[model samples]
Target: MTIAEAPPRLAAAADASLRWYPGGPYDLARTLGPLLRGNSDPSFSVQGGVIWNAFTTAEGPATVRFNPAGGAGLEPWVDVQAWGPGAGAAIESVPRLLGAQDDWHGFDEPAFHATLPRMVREARRRSLALRLPSSGRVVDQLLPIILEQKVTVIEARRAYRYLLHRYGSPAPQAGSLAPAGLVLAPTAAQWLQVPSWEWHRAGVGPQRSATVMRALRSAVALERLAGLPALEAATKMQAIPGIGIWTAAEVVQRTHGCPDSISVGDYHLAAYVGAALTGQRTDDAGMLRLLAPWQGHRQRVVRMIQSSGFRKPTFGPRMTIQDHRRH
Candidate 1:
């Protein structure tokens, strides 16, 4: 999707601020929620009503601060600040990051109005404010997903946190403007330098580590995918050895605000979605069939159903625990 026009320049460039308005009702917390791994995630954080992210740009590492200046509805303009060598590029992408660039496209097709469940329809009307955020940082988003491949959520999260704390640097040139303890994920070169033993220690197996190395080797090319269409970006991500449909969909969902990409292989998504929509668990194929009517807006439908309080029954484990060490 095309980016919204460049945000208006702030009066002062102390931290390189850019003022921007959303194309629709924009909810700051909801838009940003999916990008953050968890509260303790090192690469992204929310503190003191300010959202902080440290990212890798072609120029260098940059620290971004999103400060929302109040107004009602779409008038709430966001003032974004950036620091470090890549500050200019980082400042320029703030609107895209918050999904201001996302367009609903054919979601409003007249024939599709009643296609969604009544609960979700109500949610859609109330949640026009919900947006799909795009960080535009490919590798930073990829590594953690690599860690998650075929593993439990606890395992992936722990490994990611370990790697970030061990290899990530404090946001460069951020000085006092950045929150205390804010950290950036490792740069592409730094990722390649992580020792085999360290990967083992982080709970990443040989196959997953190999995938990480492959992705880093093609870092420049992979980073360019951020500029491509979300569908095309997801397709290109599969060219990497360890990336697959599931990983690609998850990555592009955040990096490109891909509305149609589905987490087809996510172990629990099918069941969760199936139960939410039909009150009975179903497999991935069933889930896809159910979502087919809204071809271009499947993820949006999923998000609406998810936010509507319908949940998969508690008859089974919330998440699968597949031990990868046996591999």
Candidate 2:
């Protein structure tokens, strides 16, 4: 069924509460697992069986809670609840957010399937319920990804935590989700007003902070990219200064659920894919050549390979954590 045909109860309720059952195989945890930065992500909290995510939509700040409604099964449904001014929009987004629009039926091809190792094939079979979540919001994903540029995960996450704590508003129903505070991301205006000192305190360097400001200045145009296809959306995003292929790939993976957008400049992805598939280290070009056959489903293939628990041999020094704040 189309999005327009979604349950009337969902759109009608401004308070935003609805029960949804995905007709096909679905795993809420596996599908949305990547969206969460880590268990410590201040914007998201998973407790017991429920996942709570707080974000600022065009309408306003909102908090969404996803609870499993049925017993453990391949096709279990979820009971969704939303709060705050953007509740209606958030509720309307449930279907896409839960991956209702991801079409993976034609994803697995003969050549790609034939190339997979037994372990990877088995992993793929077990994760058939996993789907790519589409947030349909650019700024929500873009800012954090920009913060991640040229920084360690720990540094990036620290900056995100600090910025949200300092500038974000409290999520309306965050108390129910966790005892700790859950906050929505800062709005465009708020992001623009953040002092350079604050950015430094948050461990964000001048370069990354400037990048965010540039995107915020064009926030309206950037948000419009959500309606575009993944490639086009990436292209539009790359037009901004400091936003490159890696940043664009990261953004579309969450915003559009683009399965083909690969992180071309990743430090370890090419090596990992190369080591797993060819038992050798490969650069981005080699990785692209290897993944050519699985063009449309390249990210899906990468995720499967990652889930297969294969790791590349570490032969060199790791990237050291840098503290720009001190500088």
Candidate 3:
């Protein structure tokens, strides 16, 4: 598509200070430029100036072609899309959350930009998206993230890949499945219909499976939670029995892009922050203490540190993945 003409669909924040490029698998580097780093997904493809892919969400089907350097007069890419109804809204919000809307806070800004180069290199190496994806609703997002909770990264990625390959739908486009065998994850309604045997086959245990089912029961309401205040939305999410602080924070950090949601219970975050700031491993309390100065943007600071290259020692034995089916 020609860069001179603005895409038929585009989203800008209330202040016009921020704009977004839509379509699936948006270009974080081209869209947000130097502000945010992108972790490439080897599964997607690039043709011409667009990255084409389909994102399967609970809201029917959406096929997106992401064109970087989009929008009118702006050299940097803004999100552009054609068919997805909620796509514009989700894409628009990401830039604002990435600080494309407001100038950075003094305390947080100093730390965020100060440590940014290191963070970008580190995030690129690890593929961490500080601004996570919000395709349509996040209830479905919670399921896959919960699958990774308290587990090794390899195990989590394996489980996600297996489940999607087995249960999800192929792209609506005839052969756009890409890189051979990639399938989108099962939607919320589809998740509800999964057989008990399939859950076992996918290596999901009773607790995690039950949590997904419990959340799916109110999927519509969960999507509506997007409009609630961050803490209130998180509280509503936590009320779902199995959804706890970490899970809720993880979901909201993307859905609301709440500046302060530090994911209080993450496995490596506390120690990562502790070692980065004080040169020693620290727990939740220490993480809070170190991050207290950047109260409004604690998560942003943590994001910067995480993007920094310093890694905590991984000497401890990895968490073992148990096949509950055998139990």
Candidate 4:
């Protein structure tokens, strides 16, 4: 049968299900995994082949469950169901949010392929289904990312968990999809109301908290960035004092699925990319030089490198994981 005429595939056994045929290759895990900040992230959960992602949309809180149909292979289809007052909008956002809308045309061009190492090329071939998912919610992405700035991942995760448990609302259909206490992100106003003491208790320091407060003050303006170009959105985000290149890149990667927004100021990324591409570890300038050729698709190159499982040599002292909650 022609692509458009393919038979409908069932994703879930439930009654309120919606099926989506991507037609092209799609890997649900590779595309959506980055959005999951941590395994313990209360906003996202995966169990029994189902991905439960909860978020606050313009309408209200939504919990979207994704079930991949067929098997683990190219061109897999997905079954989606959303619950909450914003179910319709959330369901409609499934395709964009899951990277079904991502295009991979120029990535495999002869010139581009010639530049990739054998390992990276093989990874690209194996992961053709990898697409960047755009959640279309800047705040949802921004909050967690802010907490991650200049902190150990464990510390950031603990702070995120604490904050969500304290202020986050119950996700729609939490009983069915998420862990018992799973919750959606706090509303914009709620973010503003987060007191100084609570910030300290959550292990979030003044700088990051101040950044969040600034973003929340202009939450409406920031949310409108979903409609702007990725470059433009990142620029606007950087206008805030604490939100710099690294933070902006993190936000746009999920908010716009921006292919070119590489984290220029990331602590480990420059060294990792430099070591992976060249033989030696390099600074941000060297990494940028190496990645300059893939200007429009720099982030794509980074993702390919990441998927290739290449690791840089580690010889320095690792960042200590501290718990500010005890103090």
Candidate 5:
């Protein structure tokens, strides 16, 4: 919000020094928040007012650090630095990674907010700092999400950290400037090489491991989906076995910034949506029916209301997480 209306474009000086602006109410953390699995996540980091992201580009591995710069009443601007062979590609991805490519027009309109629940309306007023970033890296988004299928968040985060740390190599060119011991996620070949025993050690059961292996076999096709429309990309993803509506939607949410993609099979999402809307719990059908009024911006609606901190009362006991490694 502190940024000027006509943000400056990065000069063609140095690829590694690329920088751009979101030109609106952009909050760096909010834009990239969903990509982080946990503090132990190898790919992302935030410290000392800077954010570092290590990822694989088609060219190779790279570490990107982005910072929002503002002081002395000056309008805030973004600063970016990169390291690796893929640094140029990583630099080019800055815009989409900060949601410069996103279109949240209708969702921001006051008229639209007038038709929503009071909590959601209030959330929208405060949520201008958020954006749904499209990372445009399909395999990068898909790997951890596949491991997350039908599992508790604790289970999923554990498995993701284990597998990533074990298979991923040290990120290239991340010196003292980058996060200490930062790691890049494994390449498709490295992922294919992971043994079943290692998967067991990571607490990924046979079914989930098989699904990941199957999806990796189509890595080329999946990577190509970034160029397609979000809905069509989701449909193509569903054609793969073990990738249902939930997984496909989740993938497109990151890779395509698909605003309408809802995690229909999620354990808590439907209840959360229901609670935010009417202060009463509801099933997936009811959530869908309630969200139907804003079919195109459903995910935007979810983000806003959930950001409002209004949710169904939690009186029930927590479900015990299954330890798949023991099986």
Candidate 6:
């Protein structure tokens, strides 16, 4: 299914401030772009007119489309010209998730507001800034975080792309914004059915793959966990066998904009936060102390720091990519 042209109103929304998709809102596909682009390991094969990684911006509910009129592959599928509620209401909510609304604008505390500007300015000199976009669905966002546990990003992304392409379905349409080889992510049932060899083929080792299967088996229970507070959600996610503090924090931060969910186990986050906040590199405890002043809004502050343009020096050896497929 292809949309020939993005309806006129959606074009206007794109003109305003929405950065991710100028066309409209994508439900689950929104998460895919970040996963693919953030880490190079999930390199999608962009063959055919199907720009599989493109996010669909419909006037109503979010969906993954092939070529829904607006040009084939990555042209940005959108439908915003309609005036009625069905799709239109969904379109309006897009801005809220993107933080386009003014009410959601302010940082939680005034003290944070005061300190962040300096940080932003400092970051500006270095050409870095923190950015946060509402990633729909806690489960979708949490998956990669879970896969990345105690491993390199390259390893995690490789595992993700392989899993999705092999087990996920093809988008209803041929070639659109969805990844060329990817359709929707594996459903809970599908996840449970995957064979052990397929996991190995996807470069996901046994441990992470098994954890994913367990989570998928309980997908319904996990989806219900969405509305919980970030901390609470983090706790629930951690209860899973392979998931841990760092992964849960990583997932919650993007899933709900949780203010205090600093990524404690990230390979580079603590150092990055340390150098960004203070001139020197620090460990997890030090990073927490630095962010303590903005306790309730810690995630927000980290977003600011990232957006502020600070860069952690990178002289150390990068983590080598390990292809579990060979194992």
- The regions of model 3 sitting more than 4 angstroms off are 1-53, 56-59, 70-74, 79-136, 174-182
Stretches of candidate 5 off by over 4 Å are 1-15, 71-73
Q: State how far residue 120 of model 6 sits from its true place (Å).
A: 4.0
Clashes of each: 0, 0, 9, 0, 1, 35
User: 232 in model 1: Cα distance from truth in Å?
Assistant: 2.2
lDDT of 5: 0.82
lDDT of each: 0.80, 0.82, 0.57, 0.80, 0.82, 0.56
Stretches of candidate 1 exceeding 4 Å from the true structure: 1-13, 72-74, 173-177, 318-327
Candidate 2 has a TM-score of 0.91
RMSD of 1: 3.1
Q: lDDT tens digits, residues 1-327, model 4?
A: 011212244324222346677677767887888898888888888886788887877777787778776755545678777677777678767778887657677877887779877656776887776889899899889999999999888888899898988999888763344556668889889988889999999988888888889989989999999999999999998888899999999999998998889998787888888777776888889998988887888898898778667788994778887666567
The ten-residue window of minimal lDDT in model 5 covers 1-10
Scored by TM-score, the top model is 5
Candidate 1 yields a Cα-based lDDT of: 0.80
lDDT of 5 by residue, 1-327 (tens): 222212234323223755466666667877787888887798888896688888989888888888787646655567887788898888778778888877878876778767876776788877887888899999989989999898888899999898888888887765555677788999888899999999998888899999999999999999999999999999999888999999999999999888899999998898888877888889999999989989898988887776666657884666678887788
lDDT of 4: 0.80
Candidate 2 on 183-241: residue-level lDDT in tens? 78888888899998999988899999999999999999999999999999999899999
Alpha-carbon TM-score of each model against the true structure = 0.90, 0.91, 0.72, 0.91, 0.93, 0.70
Runs in model 4 deviating more than 4 A are: 1-17, 72-75, 174-178, 322-327
List the lowest-lDDT window of 10 residues for candidate 4: 1-10
Q: Quote the lDDT for 45 in model 1.
A: 68
Task: Kindly indicate the candidate among 2 and 6 with the higher lDDT.
Answer: 2
In model 2, the runs with Cα more than 4 Å from the true position are 1-14, 72-74, 109-119, 174-179
Write candidate 1's Cα lDDT for 1-327 as tens digits.
Answer: 233322554324445666677744667777888887777898776877778888877777788877765655335656677888888788777778888767775786666785667766776886777888888989888888889888888889888898899999888656555677778888889999999988988879899999999999999999899889989988988998779999999999899988889999997899887877778889999999988988888998887666555657775855656555454
Per-residue alpha-carbon lDDT of model 3 for 279-316, expressed as tens digits?
78888988998878667777766665554456777635
